[model samples]
Target: MFLKLLSYPRSLIGVIIFIFLTAASAGSLVIVNILFNNRKIEDHIVEFWTRNSCRLFGVNVVVKGLENRPEGGFLYVFNHTSFFDIFAMNGWLGSFRFGAKIELFKIPVFGAGMRRAGILPIARSRREEVFKVYQAAEARIKAGERFALAPEGTRQEVESLGPFKSGPFVFAINAKAPIVPVIVKGAAAILPKGHYIPNWGVWKRTITLEVLPAVDTTPYTIDQRPLLQEKVRQIMAPYFHGDDF
Candidate 1:
């Protein structure tokens, strides 16, 4: 159905609508941020905008195991599938900042909004910048705030996942924060990687968020980072592969 519905005209229409909606919503966020200068309210705006954006694209999210999320400071890790992954996560995930690539921070209004909202930008190409990002994440967690990361680093098509990076695990241990593994299914169907236009088809538009139990990092030492990374990956692999929806 997805392939059959891949109409260029319809995709173009969807893209235009999505972009217009995003600009309007983000503009509203900027106004709110400038007026209130409050992080909490800014976060709510982002979440609200995200959910509305999902609706604009005909993407309906089904969340499971949200009760599994821990109360204390923790890091959420998810498998990267599509650009819409952020919308699915932020719409449901708590008021947590995300570890984004520094390049994203260079964009005009979007970058400014991200900074005002406390999103951490990590320069993956530079070791020092990466270290600073981890340090910031640790401090945020210790301060009782949460953060999220896609350990796979970038978007991947469904079933084409790459190895998880070790940076997030190291930050988890350093912050002594629990790691929550979330498996997102069906986002790729709505918007595949490298495509700006969304499919906007109901047949492939249901996205699910499967939140797994938090992995306690208190028991692991810095030396055991690899072991910890592999363990979390092992826990998420089954859910990623087994789900037919």
Candidate 2:
């Protein structure tokens, strides 16, 4: 890994442009939300910003297993590693409401856009707030909405799958919706764990998004949530979180 040898100058230029682009994009999204406030149009705006950001940063996304996606009304779970996991999904993994930490929902213009666009914020530490968010999610799922949640809860480097929390699985059981496993690769290398700027190096970085087959949640009650989580993790481990990924 060339790391500093190749990343310094490249990231310097990339980060500078990224800041201006993000500011403009955030302002645009805020205005669009206040004006029309239509989710479909807001989704398009988000897609444009995400996809263009990836393209400009030399993060090429190759999505696989799109046919695995069902019609709607399912909880899509992902393995987290880098912040780009969110960006990559926004760019290439299809349109769906995703849950993000409450902190991201606190950003100035960006947070306002996210809030109005119907993105659910997870208040992980506050039990009452968490319940309310899930209550909202249940209503949306009942209305045949698609939602993506990361069971791992936070970014962690792993050889296969990270340790998963029970909240997402319990939510899936309660909602009685299917689980779609999405495995992401290559983002950790491009942006690393703690860095904000992505390293393009001397060539473009490729990020692969694999949408796995859906797992039915009908049989599992809240008591069987761990079993549900394990089954989905088993399917995802073979394709990601290793050198082959």
Candidate 3:
């Protein structure tokens, strides 16, 4: 039934409405953030946006493993398939900051809100900026806040996962926070990159945020960095290839 709507001429109107709602919600969220110093209120605002987004697009979000991470202060590493992954993950991982590109900080209302919410930004081209992001992330973790990052760095459509970046692992090692791997499936089909219109349908998609056991970096020295990186990759294998890690 939803797919049928996508073929209708009125679908464009729906898309416009979605954009308007997004802008309005973002504005309201910024106001809320200013009124209350508590970050929890801002999280609630984002959750509301997430729910509305899914509804506007007629997408079903089935969440699993909510019991994982009963508290905060963990690094969330997830597969990057589409833009929707941001909202989907945020809906589940409440009150957590995200590590994004510095360019995103320039985007009008959304970017300003993200910056005000304490999202970490890194200049991908500069090596020094990478360490700066790491330092900022470590400080946030120490301050009792959690962070999420997509190591793939960009969106790609493939059955197999891309090579995981080493930055996330390094941050985890330095911060001594648990590495949580989250798998988001079916978002690519809903909306792919370089496409304006959503290929909407009554699609039922699954977003699994499995929290594996934390990697203990206490005993390992900096010389064992390669082994530590491999260990984190092995733990993430289950989501990528269905292999038992």
- The lDDT of each candidate is 0.81, 0.79, 0.70
lDDT of 3 at 175: 81
The local lDDT score (0 to 100) that residue 66 gets in candidate 1 is 90
TM-score of candidate 2 against the unseen true structure? 0.89
Query: Candidate 2's residue-wise lDDT over 85-171, tens digit each?
Result: 778998787778888889988787778877877788988788688767887688788778888898878777642467788888888
C-alpha lDDT of residue 182 in model 1: 88
lDDT of 1 by residue, 1-245 (tens): 65446555565676777677666666666787789887777787888878877776667888999999999789999988887889989998768878888998887777777776778888888867887779966777998888889998878866445688888999999999999998888888778886677764443368888999999999999999999999898888776555322
True-vs-predicted CA distance for residue 160, candidate 2, Å = 4.0
C-alpha lDDT of residue 80 in model 1: 87
- TM-scores, all candidates, are 0.89, 0.89, 0.86
lDDT per residue, candidate 3, 77-150, as tens digits?
A: 87777777776777765668778888987878878777767778877788688877787778778677888888
For residue 72, what is the lDDT in candidate 3? Answer: 49
lDDT of 3 at 27: 77
> In candidate 2, which residue ranges exceed 4 Å CA deviation?
1-7, 200-202, 240-245
RMSD of 1: 3.3
lDDT value for candidate 3? 0.70
Of models 1 and 3, which has the larger lDDT? 1
